[model samples]
Target: MKKIEAFVRHESFDAIRARLADMGLPSMSISEVKGSGRQGGYTESYRGAKTTIFMRPKLKLEMVVNDADVERAVDVILELAHTGEPGDGKIFIIPVEDTVRVRTGERGEIVLASHPDDA
Candidate 1:
């Protein structure tokens, strides 16, 4: 299994989720995060004064998918999140050694594939 973590713009999050749902990839973890990458942070006007924000607001999306689906998932994120500008965000792919369902105690892919509607 592979874990896909994507840090995307706040405004694009809703569209990203909707598109993922359409692709049967609704299960995910999302959080409001703040960070900076290559372009670094930016300056904004605060009460008519220039203020630098080192960490900007972003949406962190995380989900696990089969190896075969990695490319598709990445593509979805890229297509939706791309803004042709800085702070567009980044995606990270990591290896997931294992997973266990708390209630059923099922392991690995079995746990991942068991959606609530099927239970």
Candidate 2:
């Protein structure tokens, strides 16, 4: 199993989610996050004054899937979230040792099956 974590622009969330659904890859957790990458951050202008916005708002999407689905899921996110500019965001894949479904006492692959695509 694998866990795919993607940090994407907040504005691209809707489109990315829709694309994932179309590809039969639903079931994800989304969270609002703030951080800076290689660009370090940017500046904002308000009332003719400039302020340093050190941390930018981003959307974090997390999903656990079978090993076979990792590549496709990563591709879908990358394709849909790209903006051809800095701060477009990044994707990380981590190995998942185990998973459990609390309500039904299911484990491993069985837990993943509860997700839309796995079902």
Candidate 3:
């Protein structure tokens, strides 16, 4: 199994979510995150005062998928998240040792299967 973590622009969330859903990959954890990368920070003016903001708001999406599905999931994210600009965000793929279902005590790749209750 593999865990895919993608940090994307806040405005791109909806479209990315929709496309992932269309690809039968609707299950994921989304979190509001603040981060800084090569783009660094930008300056903004308010009331004639210039302020430098170091942390930019982004959406972090996390999904665990079967080993065979890693590329498919990553492609979906890349297709929707690309902007050809800095701060377009990043995607990290990590090996998942195992998964467990709390209720049924299920483990391993079998836990990746969709459960009716998960809907």
Candidate 4:
């Protein structure tokens, strides 16, 4: 099993989510996050003054799936979230020892099968 974590631009959330669903990769956790990358943050002007914004808002998506689905999931996220620009975000894949379905007590591959990773 594997856990996939992706931090993407806030504005791309809807498109990414829709693409994930279309690929049959459902059951994900989404969170609003703030961070900066190579581009760092930018400066904004207000009331004839400029202020530096160090942290940019982003959307973080996390999910656990079978190891075999890792590549496909990553591809889907990259394709949908990429804007060919800096601060586009990144994806991380980690090993997942096991998983359980709280409602049915399903475990491991059984739970994974319920959430098909068909990207």
Candidate 1, residues 6-88, lDDT tens digits: the string is 99998999999999888778879999988888775579998899988798888999999877778998999999999899889
Using lDDT as the measure, what is the rank order of every candidate, best first? 3, 1, 2, 4
Two-way TM-score contest, 1 vs 3, winner: 3
User: After superposing candidate 4, which stretches have Cα over 4 Å from the reference?
Assistant: 115-119
TM-scores for every candidate against the unseen true structure: 0.88, 0.87, 0.89, 0.85
Per-residue alpha-carbon lDDT of model 2 for 1-119, expressed as tens digits? Answer: 99999999988889888887777667789999998898754788999999988888899999998887889989888888898999899999999999978887888876765455354
lDDT (tens digit, per residue) of candidate 3 on 1-119? 99999999988889988987877677799999898887757899999999999998889999999887889889888988999998899999999999998988999988886667655
Off by over 4 Å in 3: 116-119
Lowest-lDDT window of 10 residues in candidate 2? 110-119
lDDT tens string, model 4, 1-119? 88999999888888877877776677799999998777756899999899999998889999888877789889888888888988889998888888888988888877876544344
Which portions of model 1 miss their true places by more than 4 Å? 45-49, 114-119
**Model 3 lDDT at residue 49:** 100
Top-TM-score candidate index: 3
TM-score-better candidate, 2 vs 4 = 2
